[model samples]
Target: MEVLGRDRGSVMSVAASGISATSFASINAAGKVTLWDVRLQHKDCMSVTTDINMLSGAEATDLLLAADMHVAVALAGGAIIAYDLRQQGVLSVYNHTCDNEAFLAGTHPPAEQTTLIADENGAIMPFDLKQCRPTAHLSDRFFGTSTTISATSFGALSNICCGLGFIRPEGEKPLLCAMGMDGSGALYTDPQLTPSGFSLLQESDLVEASGKVLNPPLPISASFLEGYVAIGRANGMYSIAVPVANSTLFEVLAAPGHACNGLSVLEWTRGDRPRLLTCSVCGVVSLWDVMPLVLETPEGDEVIDEDLPSLDVAESVRDAVGQQVSVNCGAVIGDNLLVVGDAMGFITSCLLV
Candidate 1:
């Protein structure tokens, strides 16, 4: 859990509240989840906080917020719980007893109403918010195991050294992404749709991208936007790629010596371009101008063909930053506000600039 303070109260994960600019949620190493309102509060992040304990009684590994303000908490024992922030009560409790390792869960920005949870061993469980539980129609190996579906180079990879996300481009259906430490990632797409979201998995195709760059081969984080997915590395660099199933292409965004533990993307407006917000192991927050790396034309509709030849590319980087503190994970409240927490159990907030 990256317990720098060797305690359960140490922050393990943080999630942004898309509904509010100054509000967010997080879970500590001790499995305690808290709602945060830092609008005009202290920089320490403790300016205003409310602890929400669901009685899972274990360390929570990761968390994310839904548009309805439902906070999804992924715990260590394979059980994931969701809470309704509006009522400050439990929404449902789900148990995945297959893998004992800490699980990771996330929300796709394009489809924030939906969430996906994956175990270190590589089983993905999609949460059907309508049913208030993992989908019952899908088989256990429906998506195939991440380690074997389309994988190679086992010796150099750690199954838990992973990241998962999904992207919904302007005119395309949403696509789910699962990544492992070997630098190989797979994409699963289902054209059919449902009210609860992509529930029918009649048959899915696995697109494997061999394009990889793992500096230290350690655990990493993922954040997605439009058609691109950024993979944060252990040695302080991130790889931006098309995320198509082919051999794939890569654009490395470097932050020398600054181990990246977290990443978030915010799309641009008419006056400015898109940006990638990154938080590091040492609690430093930085911004990378991302418009140039994207394949989209200025019109923002047409994109480069995903069937492009495999190649590694580098682009000129324009970056910005803010004050530093000891950080474990964080969430972007709105366009510019940032809220983060560390293993010492201290919550903090800062501006991207």
Candidate 2:
């Protein structure tokens, strides 16, 4: 795979194809779009200039891995836009502003084209990227009364948030979890109910313990899996797994993960096995073995470093592409490339070879 960075600009968001595994795209602080042809050898593909001026003072917040040639980007101003690479860097698609567009997830089956956006306002807006209009909006009274929305995802089904608004991956139906600013979180399923499936609301939905003031980090971001959810706080990381029954298993501190600026989940190993990766504002990256951890309890949980090689460890490490700074946002590109963007507008591609 090829890693490219403009002379001075840092990338805002990066996304790649989970199917082809050889294509990727990124948007920079300058609002330029760079589409890479990973199938080719050495510095492949050209950079396309997107005249799409970012809303003034807005920064790129999050990115969604959607249809091939199409990438969804969330702006700091709470707006979301889908960029079509086939149109040569044209951000022809746009959506309305809401609470921070922390996460976006698309639908499956008949409505695979539908996408969901979760914001800080505790509102989950479902937008038909194909039709360009919102179809539905769901909000939990408990969440409205308690937490402020943070990160969100559809993979966990609908939108998932930590400390509130944690979206989970797809299943028989959509599931959503909200993390309260106070350190408690609640999980809900089938959000589109008449009275809102209050019975299905997972009891003791509260996650991570919080005091008057949380240490490390608050629930700034979260990542979702089929039955598991990973949350990034100022202090560390936590994972929660919900079973068919009321078997809610969780990790209070899944390793001393960093104060996350942003995070993403990658389904690799031929899509059979998955890994949990967390990126911090300090530019440190950690990859956890979800397989081994599941096979045993925390007391028996194997040390992550002993199980796998640490990518950020070593002397041969290449200095980050642009500057010596923290990576505020990160997304997995295919299975091998990691694209990191920092506050200073510096974006770099790290090879996971």
Candidate 3:
């Protein structure tokens, strides 16, 4: 396996480009976005950096793969920016001025043209990429759902989206899926019913299990499996289920795990069953297979580390690519090819057996 590496800043997130499978992008805490081409030995193809001071802990960024090779980044400065990948630079640094809170998360499904940008306080705004501005929010239409309530009223993990996806509602467009603090996931979006935009679809109001409070959903990836988002349960359990959905689609029952710092969906291994991986601080990776996971998909898919090996990541990385640092985020190229960003601002791509 050929392991190749490159250093940028410190990547906070990395995902495959919606436009190209061999291409991906990574963003650092300081709002530096670096584009990489896996075909070029994982070399840095292009990059854009904001003027934020890296140590100030302000003006942070989260990414959404917008349409037409454009990446949307949410900033703590209450503004959203769009970068045109084809031009190898930013198209709109201030695409939209949002609410007064930090924009925490964003998601744009491949089928949709609008991107849902959520704030730290949970209020979500739909930005029409074609129009380049914030569209009507679901709350403006007076829709009532657990997700909207969580966002407005601040209900634990409900508003701070770790991941975003959609469910195929019986409408022209699918319902937007978001998590509720409890297991009662919520879905929104109905064209005929609510012409203005969306409505309260449904909330999965689940009770506490065994009297044990369920951990809030952590960082998530919507690309691992169709119709599902892999969540790192705050309890360190890895789950391959739609976030806050009524049912737990899949969870690997196993020993308790380290607090998952990150979770990325990697179905790159040549097989029918795609895999979900979780990494803790310094990049401790654990893998799970879904074919063995059942249909009713049990709960407590522990996102633990004991089941997997947390070998010294820095040393392992040094041996693999000669650069030793904690892994920040990752992206997969082809079947068996792995690419990751490290604490030292390095991006590495290699074939992992």
Candidate 4:
């Protein structure tokens, strides 16, 4: 394991390109984004600074690799900037009028050109890369005409929308999962942009509500792994079946004791079995064997088996710096290298055992 130190500020976000895993992007608390080439001994290949005055007290929230050698940054002020590595300056910047802070930004997996940005109000907007503008607001498109309007709208309804992920099931259209600030979540499938309609799935509809107001699990991050949506929450980690039907609630997974702040799903094959790499706020990194259990009922519906086998934590690594810093984000680069960003302004690269 190798630890890299940064003196600028806390590393807020990290993203690795699908086209070239050796290249990765990271944003710091000071709104400085840097692209690094891990193959070149983690050298800073490029760097840029966003408008700090326009941030309005908000930090850089998310970073993503939109295309080959292209990086997109989502600011807390709802500004999305696309940067090309070959270019000297930013390629383009799209500004959206968001009442709340932006939380996450990503591109649709199937259509890599379509960019999606999620905010604190639970609003998800789809942006066209070519046009450099938002295509539609997902909440308005999905449930604008419903009688129970507010319930369908994620706008400041709960704490905030913390995480978002796209799942592509075999022989089916892509599905989008939005994890609310609290434990509540929702799913959208077969989304249409023209008419703006989709099949919706809500957590309230699947699980019986417990009216207790104690400390509910707050999802901090999420990802699609091994045909399931893995959610990293304050209490523990949980996984729900993708393309969620009416039967499955999030199944809890035994994880680190502290809050799970970030997660990265790497495709790994261990004797035909799938696995994943998970990291937590307390700087606990673990490897798990993924085995999803699904049973076909007589009613011609699929349901997750109650006695699903628990994921085994095959390996674990604690804090490399030993300063008790939170791992804000992480990504897997190359074959077996794991790079992570911490709240203490340190980027560490680990060679998996």
Candidate 5:
């Protein structure tokens, strides 16, 4: 595997453009967003700094690249800013009147136009990209009356809320996955629900591999791959089947001594079977060949679960950067390029064989 490294100064988040796999966008702790052409030796194409005051410790927390050549940045001070990459300036800035900090921002399936912004209070706001304003507040849809309680109570419910992904079933409307801390999660499937209102299809509680209730599993990252959602927690990882009547736990992969902070599905090697890449807070990166539990249907019969396969721990690389620097996030760009971002603001590109 070919490896390349570049230090961009304390990167908070990194995202590759969907239109161009070699193009990447990253936001730093100083509120500076830089666009890079990784194919050209990680050249900086453009840079833009947000207007958030550094004195207030407000920085760009999360970023999302829209298909319209616009990047949406979620700020730590409860604001969302849409920046036009072509113009190299801010398209619009939106404040949701929320006192909590923003955690992550993403788009739902189907249209993939409206930007969903999740905050620390487990509130999600659907912002219209065309109008550059929030269409509705959706805290009640995900967390119910948990938002109306005290900060301590809300904090006990979950640490933060982040948009996982959109699940599209065969004959139903698309549902949005909102994963929170302490294994608190919800799936919203009602089409009539809007920024003005919201509804949910299911709510799930946290459970261990032994089916015991737990307080703080701390789901840090999640990704949807091969009809399943893999949630990386502080303790381990859980794979859940999508579009079910309730949240069905498929399998639990233990992490032992690592706190899973980043996860990405690598579509390499296997034709239809994809590999899972997980990064830990302890500066360890491991690849796993996950054989998901299969289901089968006989002639004119109901579907039943087949034999479950074990998770194989494949190749691993420890401290890809140096000692003790945590790998924050990573993505598999192009065909075989594995790009990882670290706490020290370095991006390492590895060409997997």
Candidate 6:
């Protein structure tokens, strides 16, 4: 994808979603956010003239996709700002500690009018999106490192070293799964978020491994399923059906050496199975054989389920775009389409077919 921005700085974050049959929003690194109509076939996307200088000497590190594609930018100076794309309004610019020591690491709860932001201080601050003010903040006893969604369910993962995946059922309060990031990949069931006993994603009646723990294998990305959770780990990609029954939760479909630094998972099969697209640091791109994931207990993890049928590889789409660059962030646009942002400041879009 070709990105046009007024700021000379590289794009820190980008989000694109089908707003309608004709319009989409593309926010760039310079913080110059714009909406485009591919149907009009215009050379440049429609620009929303703003008096507020978003990219003017502003340093934003990340962007979140919120309701109506509301763009929230995490500033380098440990503050957060949410902007509405459709309407020309500044939703809120969060005011917190101004100390240069603390940085805004990440933000979550993208859909809610209120969202949570992870700070360098290892705290998750819940902010009201409408007011752009902080309501409450909580600490997870660890640094706010990385977060992701489960393709099947609305659940999400907050992986702090050995971490917790938060799941809230309809009309029910959120539940926390005490998972470890030990190099070994699996979902563990610990009723409590504190350090305690937990169960791993295994098949035996004695599924919980006592001394064995989860070690951070590689960079991990997550997606949800109807009742299960799929994780894209660094060594390979695995899926775990939560609420462990007699079945194996973690299935290592792809093995080690498959760099999953930049992995993107989405609601695939028209909401049936979860689709997985991964771009590695080495510049290799691969697709997983995940169809609406269906796993049975005791049968062990199978590669070809009714949902996940096969693995596909489209070797380094980044390489095809001329010279290869180190990729850090990427997002899925509709189906069979991907846009990647690299350290070199290149935003390349590709048809995944």
Runs with alpha carbons beyond 4 Å of true place in candidate 2: 1-3, 40-57, 69-78, 89-97, 105-111, 137-174, 178-186, 194-214, 236-249, 258-270, 298-318, 344-346, 351-353
Best by TM-score: 4
**Model 4 agreement with the true structure over 1-353: per-residue lDDT tens digits:** 56755637888777766666576778887677787777675467677776644643566666776545354544645566666655645667766666434433332232345455666666666655556566543432223221122222232224466666655556544455666655565565533322122222345433446754433455556656434665655545444444445223334333443234434322232234545566766666665544554322222344443543444443233446767777777776655567788778788876654
List CA RMSD, all candidates.
10.6, 8.0, 8.1, 6.8, 7.6, 9.0
Per-prediction count of colliding residue pairs? 3, 24, 12, 1, 1, 22
Q: Candidate 2, residues 19-88: lDDT per residue as tens digits?
A: 4556555566656656665556643265556434444346555555454425444444555555565565
Error of 2 at 260 (Å): 10
**What lDDT does candidate 1 reach at residue 63?**
68
At residue 347, give the lDDT of candidate 3.
65
- Model 5 TM: 0.70
Give lDDT per model, in order. 0.48, 0.47, 0.47, 0.55, 0.52, 0.43
Worst 10 residues of 1 by lDDT: 194-203
Q: What TM-score should be assigned to candidate 2?
A: 0.66
lDDT of 1 at 158: 36
Model 3 Cα displacement at 132 (Å)? 3.2
TM-score of decoy 4 = 0.72
- What are the per-residue Cα lDDT tens digits for candidate 1 across 1-353? 11112223777777766566666677777555666666443322321222334344456667666645455444545556666655665666666654433233232242334345566665565555544566434322222222121221111113653566555556655555666654554555531221121110111211225534334433366666666766676656555555333233244333332334433222111124446666676655556665563543333233343422222211111121132335666665666655556666766555554
Off by over 4 Å in 4: 5-7, 55-57, 99-111, 136-159, 192-215, 242-273, 292-318
For residue 133, what is the lDDT in candidate 2? 52
Per-residue lDDT tens digits for candidate 3, residues 1-353, read 23444545666666555556576677777777777776784467777766555322365545555535365544545656666666655556443333323221222345455555555544456555555566553332222231222122222224444444454412233445554333333444532232122111122212255654344343343333444544554445454443233322333433333444433322323345455444444444544454344233455454444344332212134345555457655655544456666767666655544
**Model 6: ten consecutive residues of lowest lDDT:** 99-108
- Tell me, by lDDT, which candidate is best: 4
Where is model 3 more than 4 Å wrong at Cα?
1-3, 53-57, 70-77, 86-88, 95-112, 137-159, 167-175, 180-185, 189-224, 242-271, 296-324, 334-336, 350-353
Off by over 4 Å in 6: 1-8, 16-30, 34-59, 67-77, 84-91, 97-112, 136-216, 235-270, 291-309, 313-315
TM, every model: 0.64, 0.66, 0.63, 0.72, 0.70, 0.60
Best of the two (3, 4) by TM-score: 4
